[model samples]
Target: MSSNLGKIDVEVEVKSPVDKFWNGIRDSINLFPKASPNEYKSIEVVEGDGKSVGSVLLIKYTEGFPLVTFSKEKIESIDEANKTLVYSVIDGETLKYYKSFKGTLTVIPKGNGSLVKWCCEFERANDEIPEPQIIKEFAVKNFKNLDAYLIGA
Candidate 1:
């Protein structure tokens, strides 16, 4: 009905502190596979100042048409101060129609617990918006995955 796509934003509260959760996410090699499996199939460090910004991280994510599965995403930017990891799509099936996707994971402190806000923005070429509920479903599942991982750690 609407060609303009809406944004998908989801937030989850973790028992862990902000600093701890922030550190966990900033470490892509350690946290990528666990926190987000669908997008980040795997992350491999290629070249850079090792651990610092400009480090090349080959990311394997969902790709393939008809039945999308996995592809590659290069680490475009990493900011530890704001606890943000921005990745640009290099090669992926999902990128074909989705065009582009920017994901951000942030932690906001609230008393003892912290609010883990995760969001993904996508650009669609067609007017096809596969069921609005799917967005909520994805958000819940993704956030739940992060919550479990944080609590267990």
Candidate 2:
């Protein structure tokens, strides 16, 4: 993404309040599919328990006609102190395009509510990187979906 600019950031807030969002993050393994809906139609454990470090998840996204399979995530580090979860694409079809994918999600509470700060940096295995719009769309969509889910909860 030589032509791409600096880091992109997206913020989402739900009406259910901060506690509900934090709860969803805490029980992410169990609530992911439910919270994100069709983005993760199903998830299977690839290794380790779904809790703590070394846990791996394989998610199946619901693509209408063509099957667009991607990875779940390989947990690299989990810090409850910082309230952040770090993950990389260890196993996923998406890795073919992105040589390395690293992301950090932090859950923080604001004055009257809370939200999640999702950030990521990636490298292209090949010479091409995905268009910035696609990346931003994906990131924003995920936040919107999760925010809606939290409001429902």
Q: What would the per-residue lDDT of candidate 2 be over residues 1-153, giving only the tens digit for each residue? A: 453323456566545466666667767667777866766677777888866688888867777413347677888888886678888878766666666677787777876667678777676665565533465566666666666777776
lDDT, candidates in the order shown: 0.63, 0.69
Q: lDDT tens string, model 1, 1-153?
A: 345554577778777778876776667566867787655567677666436655665656554212345545555666777776665555556566666666666777867867878776676656774523454565566556666787787
Candidate 1 weakest lDDT stretch, 10 residues: 62-71
Q: What is the lDDT, from 0 to 100, of the residue 92 in candidate 1?
A: 56
Per-candidate count of clashing residue pairs (backbone under 3 Å): 3, 0
TM-score of each: 0.69, 0.81
Model 2 segments more than 4 A misplaced: 1-8, 65-67
